[model samples]
Each structure stands twice: as C-alpha cells, then as structure tokens.
Target: MIAVANLAWRSVLNRKNTALLTILTVAVSVVLLLGVERVRVQAKESFANTISGTDLIMGARSGNINLLLYSVFHIGNATNNVDWKTVKDIVGQPAVKWYIPISLGDSHRGFRVTGTTTTFFEQYRYGRKQLLSFQQGREFDALSDVVIGAEVARQLNYKLGDSIIIAHGLSDQSFTRHDDSPFEISGILNPTGTPIDRGVFVSLAAIDAIHEGWETGTKRATGAAFAKDYTNHEPTAVTAVFIGLKSRLQTFSLQRQINEYRFEPLSAIIPGLVLRELWSMMSVAEKTLLVVSGFVVFAGLLGMLSSLLTSLNERRREMAILRAVGARPHHIFLLLVSEAGLLTFCGIIVGILMLAVLLLFGVPILHAQYGLVVDVWHITEYELSMLAIVQAAGILIGCLPALSAYRQSLSDGMTIRV
Candidate 1:
C-alpha cells in the first residue's frame, strides 16, 4: 500500500501544472460560494438590527413599505410632510409613550439631512437597543447647530465647530443652496449601524431656519432667520415621526387613531412588520443569487473530475509498473482517491483564506454605505455545512476515476497495458 501511494504521489507531481490549475479553479469557486452565503446571512442580520426598540413609524398617507424605506432606511424621499399639530396630538394621546418627529428633504452634499428633536438621542435605539453616544462634542443644543452621523463625519471629515453648507434639496446636485445659512457641526455621533449613521440630524428648527430665507427674501436681509417668537411664524411641518408605545397592545389602537385623525391623512406603520415585508419582497432575488453560486461550485467539481480523468490516462504506465510489483487493484484505487482528497482539501483551505481577507476589507464599506454591520470573524452554521458539502463532492469526483483505475488493474492481471 505504501509503495502504491508513493507511485500515486509521483504521478500527480509529474503533471503538477494541470493539477494546480484544477485546484485553483475549485478554490475560486468555493470562495465565491461561501462568500455569497456569508453575506446573505450577515446582511439579513444587519437589516434586522438596524432599528430596534422603536414600536412604529408614522408618516403621510402612504404604504407601510414606503414609510419604512424613507423614515428608517433612508432609501426614498418622503412625498408629503405631516402637520406638526397632528404630531403634537399624537404625542398627547393616552396610548402614546414617546414620539420623535423627523423632518427630511434637505442634504449636505450627498448625505441626507434629518430634522429631528433632541429626544432622538434619548429614545432612538439600535443593535440590541443600544443608546446613541457621541464620539466627540455634544448633541445639537442651539437651533443652528447640528449633530452629524458617524459616516457623515468620517466621509466629510467634519469636526466640532466646523460649519457646513446644506443644499436646498435632498439630491447631491441641487440648484438651490442654503449656502447662506450654513449650520455649525456641534457634534459627531458614534457608529450606530443604522440609517442614522448615514444621516445628519438637527433640531427641527434648524431645517426651518435654513429654508426660512427661501421663496421670500425678507429674512435674507436682516438675517433674523429664526422667528424670535415661535408661534408668530408659519407652523412648521416635519417629514415623518417615530412613535413608541407605552405597551405593545396599544400599538394598533394608536395606529388607528393616527390614521382616523381629521387633521390630515396619515399612515402609521409597525417597524417590525414593515421590515419583514421588505425581506419577503427581496427573497426571490436572494434565492436566485444563491442558486447561481451553487452552480458555480458544481461546475468547479466537474472540472476537477475531468482533470483527474485526463491525468489518469497519462499515469497508466506508472500504474502498470506498480501492479507489476504486486500492488493490488484496491491499493491502486486508494492511491487515486488519496490524491483527489488532498487536492480538494488544499483548495478548500485556500478558499477559506480568500474569504477571510474579503470579509475583513468588506465590513467597513458595508457599514459606512448601507449601515450593515457584518462580523468578519464568525462563521455561521450554513457556512460550515457548505464546507462539508464541498469536501464530499470532491470525494465523489475522486471515486469516478478511482473506479475506472480499479477496473484497469483487474484487467491487467500483471504487467499488461501501459
């Protein structure tokens, strides 16, 4: 058996380039397959963790999905702004616990500007209901001061006391500019792994002040941006609001009350429900990507099989010599199987190393852009199962050529075909 194994090793080494190419192909495919599965699991985890502790999100009369997309995910624009009076009424309701109003529709460069109250720092929670913490400086205290999210601060390189010019519209390139009424960066927040990380938050009054000079140039001359008397100015409107109920049971009742309010047409969405619905909608795309990745792995195994079969023909003379030296047919079969097993195991190891490098670099970018926090080190159950399946498939490929060699050894009897 030892002599037969040595001959197998020699045979593989003789055609080193072909074997190496086969291993490389298998390694790359396994890397791609495992990479996709890792992302799928982590991305779902990140999405679920983005917003927590918040009971529901209330906004203008629109679909629940739409409210989540604009208010929580910052994906799309809010079509209408709800009346501040209605928001106040909701705040005063018996079923209500706490509510934070968020006004949107402005931007500083490409980042979305979120007009929210100071209560957000106290109420808004993310990733296991963790509270917001400031990396540097304090929360927005003055009307003209703003607190930028972590990604916004890092991308824009903002610091405490730095004044930033906010654009009039939500787009990166807006014809209108609030370059006149730039807000000073009062604070920069720590990473939250939520849409808030990509958002620029400020007091609702700050948004009003920036746009106060627009349409009517009356305030532009005197620079009396904020109305000294709060009630004297046109009643402010906010884009959307997040509501937290005192009890889970009060959620539906509060949503109904907000929807039936005569003040204006509004929609109230349960954040968890909306998130689930969003995931459901994306299920098809996710499944399709996974299928394609699986096929790629299957193709790699097929290529490995073909490479081994082709090499078996060239190594026939070596096999004949081994058989002449009293090596049994079963020993020849074991030798072939061992070579395939070694090549596959090596490929899988290389694939895992490649995946590790990819995840290490990918985490920061994913967190920055999409607020998806991925843990690079942890390998889930699915990944482990996939690794096992890859090795099993490699063994099966080996068996195909191993069986053919067994047949040849039986037919050769002693020293026969080369």
Candidate 2:
C-alpha cells in the first residue's frame, strides 16, 4: 500500500499542471460553498442583533413587517401615525418600564431624521443589551439641538455645534426646507452597526417645531415668527414607539391589549418574533444560493474525474512497466485512487486558506458598507462536515478511473501499447 501511494504521488507530480488545475477547480467550488454559508449565518446574526432589550414595538395598524421596517429599520414610510395621547396612555401601563416615542417623516441630507425623547439615549439597547454611548458631545437637550449618529457625522462631515437645516420631507432634495428651525449638532453617537447609525435624532418637540404652520405638505404663509418656545409645541402624533416592560412575562398580554385598543387602530409586535419571520421570508434566497454552490462543487468533482480519465492513456506504458516489474493490477487501482484523494486533500486546504484571506479583507468592507460583522476565525460544525463530505466524494469519484486502470492493466499484461 505504501509503495502504491508513493507511485501515485510521483505520477501526479509528473502531470503537475493538470493536477494543479484540477485542485484549483475544486478549491474554487469549496470557497463558494463555504463563503455563502458564512455570509448567510452572519447576516442573520447581524439582523437579529440590530435591536435587543426592547420588549415590543408599537405603531399604527399595519403589517408586522411594515411596522418593524418603518419603525425600527427606517426602511419605509409609516402608513399612519399613532396618536400621542394613545402613546402616553400605553406607556403609562403598569407593566411598562420605559418607552421611547418615535416621530419620523423628516430627513437631513438623505439620512432619516428621528424625533424622540432623551429617554431614547438612555433606554435604546442593541447587541447583547448594549447601551448607546456618545463618541463626542451629549444627547440633545434643547428643541434646536440634534444628535447625529456616527455614520451621519462621518459621511456628512458634521461636528458638534455645527448647524444643519432639516428638510420637511424624507426626500434628498426637498424644496420646502425648515430654514427657520435649523438645529445645532449637540451629540454624535458611537457606531452601533445598525440602522441607528444612520439616524438623526431630535426631541419630539423639535419635530413639531420644525413643521409649525405647515399645512398639508406645503408651508402656509403664517407670517408669524418661528416659535422658539418648544416647551409649548408638542407632537400630536408619532410614527411609532419602543416599549420595554418591567417583566417579559407580560409581553404577550400587553401586546394583546394594545392590539385590541378601542380608541384607534394599532399594532404591537415583539421584535425578536418579527425578525424571525423576516428571516424565514428570506430563507428561499438563502437556499437558492446554497443549491447553486452545491452544483459548483459537483462540477468541480467532475472536472477532477475528467482530468484523471484523460491522463489514463498517457500513463498506460508506465502502468505496463510497473506490471513487468512485479506491480499487481490492484496496485494500479490503488495508485489512481490515491492520486485523486491527494488532489482533493490539497484542494480543500487551499480552499480554506483562500477563504481566510478573503475574510481578512472582506470583513471590514462588509461591516463598513452593510453593518455586517462576520467572524472569520470561527469554523462551524457544518463547515467541517461539508469538507468531510467533499473528501469522501472525491475518493468515490476516483474509483471510476481506478476501475478502468485495473481492467487495462489486467488485459495488457506487460505489453507496451505505444
């Protein structure tokens, strides 16, 4: 067996170019397979970790996905605004521990502007119950004060104390700008790698203050001076609210109560459950990617099979010489099988190395662009199992050429075909 293995090694080295190409083909396939799996797992993790510690997200009556998207992710416009009176009544519940009112429908240079209370800075939590902290300055205290996120500050070149004009609508180019109510950047939040990083936060009063005398979508000529006394100006409605309960056991009851509220139509959703639903909806795309990768791997294995079969005729004289020198037909069979196994092993190693190198450079880019943090060093059980399956399949594929070599050796005996 050892002699056959040594002969197989030498034979592959003799056809080094073809062997290397075959290995590279398998390696590429392995990279694609493993890369897709890694991204799928990490993307889900990032999505789930975007918001935590909040018991429920409450908004005007809408689909669970729509409420979550518009309220938490700032993805879409709200269908309707929750009455501020309803918000106060719900948050005043016995089970409610803290609440953050969210008022939207404004923008600052393409970044979503969120109107919330100072409690937002104190109560909002993310990944592992992490609290929001300031990288510079402090939370907004005054109506004219605005707190920008890390990404907002970085991308817009904003600094604490710099004045910014808020647009009336969410569009990047709004004609009706709130030029009268420019806000000063009072704080810059640390990056949370979530939608929070892209938000511009201000007091709810600020939201109403900016839209003073605005009727419908256009500003009316009130001719009155912009109200600087924000204490009197209050938001009559808000886009949504984030609520935390004193105990998680009461989550379902409160959700039911809020959903059945009589005064107005409303919806309450558990963030974790809604996130799971969103991920399940995306599972079809994930499965499609996996299937495509599997096919690539199959094609790679077939490439290896083709290489070995094509080399068989060229190595027939070598096999005959071995037979004359007392090598058995079974030895030729073992030699072909060992050659295939060796190529596959090398390919797997190269593929892992390639993936590691890619992650080393790709992780930062992904995090910067899409807020996805992929752990490169962690190797899951699934990956190890996949590699084992690939190796076994390679050995199985080798048997075809091995069997052919065995038959050729038996028939030719010590005769040199050429």
Candidate 3:
C-alpha cells in the first residue's frame, strides 16, 4: 500500500501543471459551497437577533412583513400613522409593561431619522438581550439633541455637538428641509450589527416640533419660533410602536385584542415569527444558490475525472512497466485512487485557508453594508458533512479511470502499447 501511494504521488508530480489546475478548480468550488452556507446561516441569525425582549410590534393595519420592515428595519414608509390616543389606550392595558413609540418619515443625508423617547435607549434590546450603549456621549436630553448610530456617525463623520439638519421626508435630496430646527449630535451608539446602527434617533416631540408649519409637505416661511420646550410638545401620531409585556404569558392575548380593536385598524406581530415567515418566503432563493454551488462542485469533480482519464493514455507504458515488475492489477487501481484522494484532500485544505482570508476581510464590509456579523472560525456540522460528501464523490469518480488503467495493464502486460 505504501509503495502504491509513493508511486501515485510521483505520477501526479510528473504532471504538476494539470494537477495544480484541477486542485484550484476543486478549491474554488469548495469555497463557494462553504461560503454560501456560512452566509445563509449567519444572515438568519443576524435577522433573528435584530430585536429581542420586545413582546410585540404594533403598527397601522398592514401585512406582517410590511410592519416588520417599516417598524423594525426602517425599510419603507408606514401605510398610516397610529393615532396617539390609540397608542395611549393600548399601552395603558394591564398587561403592558413599557412601550416605545417610533415616528419615521425623516432623513438626514440618506440615514433614517427615528423619533422615539429616551425609553428606547433603555428598553430596546438586541443580540442576546443586550441593551444599547453609547460610544461617545449620553442620550438626548434637550429637544434639539440627537443620538446617531455607529454607522451614521462613522459615515457622516459626526462628532458630539455637531448640528445636523434633517430633511422633511425620507429622500436624501428633499425639496423641503427643516433648516430652522437643526439637531445637535448628543450621542453615538456602539455598533450592534443591526438596523439601529444606521439610524438617527431623536425625541418624538422633536418630530412634531420640526413639522409645526409643514402640514402641507412644504415648510411655511412664517417667522414662528421653533419650540424649545419638549415638555409641551406632543406627537399626535406615530408610525409604529414597540411593546413589552409585564408577563410574556399575556403576549398572545394582548396581540389578539390589539388586532381586533374596533377603534382603529392595527396589526400586531411577534418579531420572531414574522422573521421566520420572511425567511421561509426567501428560502427558495437560498436553495437556488445552494443548488448552483452544488453544480459548481460537480463540475470541478468532473474536471478532475477528465484530467485522470486523459493521463491514463499517456501512462499506458508506465502501467506495463509496473505490471512487469510483479505489481498486481489491483495495485494499478489503488495507485489511481490514491492520487485522486490526495488532490481532493489538498484542495479542501487550501479552500479552508481561502475561506478564512475571505471572512477576515469580509466581516467589516458585510457589517457595514448589511449589518451582518459573520464569524470567521465557526464551522458547523453541515459544512463538515459537505466536505465528507465531496471526498467520497472524488474517490468514486476516480474508479472509472482506475478501472480503465487496470484493464490496460492486463491486456498489454510486459509490452509497450506503442
């Protein structure tokens, strides 16, 4: 067995160029296969961990996905605002513990502006029930103060006390700007790898104070003084509300009551369930990517098979020499199989190194662009199973060429084919 392995190693080195190319092909395929799986798993984890400790997310009547997108993700505008009276009535229930009302529809240089109370900083939890912490300064205290997320602060180069003007709507180039009421950067949050990292938070009263004369979508030029006393300013409506229950057992009951409320059209959703439903809807695309990666791996294995089969013709005389030297027919088969196994094993090692380098550099980019935190060194059971399957397939593929070589050795024993 050792002699056959040594001979196989020498044979592969004799055609070093082709062997290297085949290894590279296999390595690239492995990288793609493993990379897709890693990202898929990490993305689901990031999505699920985006918001936690909140029992329910309530907003104007809309689909669960829509409510999640607008309220939690700040992805789109809400269909309608939940009246303050309705919001108060819902939070006043005996089952409710704490509630944070969020108002949207404002932007500052493409970053979303969220209007909520200081309770948001205290009550909002993410990633294993972690509370929000400031990286630079304290939370907003004055009406003109604003708290920016990590990405927002980094991208905008905002420092504490830098005043930023917010636009009237979500557009980066809005025609109506709230120039008269600029907000001072009071705090910057630590990176959470979630939508919170891209948001600009302010008091809900600030949302109302900025739109004092913009009832028609355009700010009126009236020389009205901007309200400084947030104590007197109150928001009449909000885009959505994040609710926490006194006891988790009352979550479903309150959800049912809110959904069936006759005073207003409302939708209440559990974040985890909606996220699961969203992932289910997106699973088709995920599976499609995985299938494409599988085909790529198959193509790489086929390339290896082609290389082995092509080398058989050139090595016909070599096989005759081995057979004349008292080597058995099974020895030739083992030699070929050993060569394929070595190539696959080496390719897997190289692929893992490549994946490590990729994750090392890609972690920051993914977190910055999509708020996805990918672990560099975590290998799941599924990935190990994939590697095992690839190894088995490679050895099986080598059988065809190995059998051909075995038969040639028998027919052309002790004689050169040429």
TM-score of each: 0.83, 0.89, 0.89
Which residue pairs show collisions in model 3? none
TM-score of 1: 0.83
By descending lDDT, how would the candidates be arranged? 3, 2, 1
lDDT of each: 0.80, 0.89, 0.89
lDDT of 2 by residue, 278-338 (tens): 9899989988988899999999999999999998988888888888889888888898999
What's model 1's lDDT at 130? 83
Clashes of each: 0, 0, 0
Arranged by TM-score, best first: 3, 2, 1
Report the error of model 1 at residue 52, Å.
1.5
Q: Identify the candidate with maximal lDDT.
A: 3
Better of 1 and 3 by TM-score: 3
lDDT of 1: 0.80
Give the Å error, residue 75, model 3: 2.8
